[model samples]
Target: GDSVTQTEGLVTLTEGLPVMLNCTYQTIYSNPFLFWYVHYLNESPRLLLKSSTDNKRTEHQGFHATLHKSSSSFHLQKSSAQLSDSALYYCALSDRTGNTRKLIFGLGTTLQVQP
Candidate 1:
């Protein structure tokens, strides 16, 4: 079984501050694909970044995350936080079960950026 964890349920930050959302995962598979999905107020969740290679950094939409196999972590980070960056972020792990691939999502973290 595979599972993802997002330590922060809510993160509040002022504009221009650095942002970090902790994400960690555990799986029996040797190589697992990790992903970060962003959900806006009324929009469908979209993929922000994904990586299967260990120790490689993936970036999208001003956010970046590195997959660390040694620590089993894929923490999302941004140098500066903006109001537009506020959203619900989900950490997910890809799993393949009997020719089908599915994603296991975490509880999700809400990023609230204020002016």
Candidate 2:
């Protein structure tokens, strides 16, 4: 079965520091779309970035990630951390196996930024 894995459970950082959330995945299918979804305190989870092209960088909401099929990774990175950047982040892969494409998500990562 296909699965997504986020090695880091929690990341704590001070304002102005850089941040990285590790993400990796495994799948049996060849064509799959990887996504980064951010969930704030009250707002519903929303797609931050997504890409299926290997080695292409995708950016959204001040964050950027490049999917590397060779490494099976799509690590999210930000140049500087902001207090408002604290949130729950999830890495997901869409399995286009059948007529229905299912999204498999990694264990969520919580980012806490302090001023």
Question: lDDT at 52 for candidate 1?
Answer: 51
- Which stretch of 10 consecutive residues in model 2 shows the poorest summed lDDT? 94-103
Predictions in order: lDDT: 0.90, 0.91
Off by over 4 Å in 2: 96-99
- lDDT of each residue in 6-107, candidate 2, tens digit only: 956889999999989999999987878899999998999999999858899998878999999898999999999999999999999986568776889998
TM-score list, all predictions: 0.93, 0.93
lDDT, candidate 1, at 8: 69
Query: Residues 53-105, candidate 1, lDDT per residue (tens digit)?
Result: 77888888889999998999999999999999999999998854456668899
Off by over 4 Å in 1: 96-99
Candidate 2 Cα deviation (angstroms), residue 90: 0.3
Clash tally, candidates in order: 0, 0
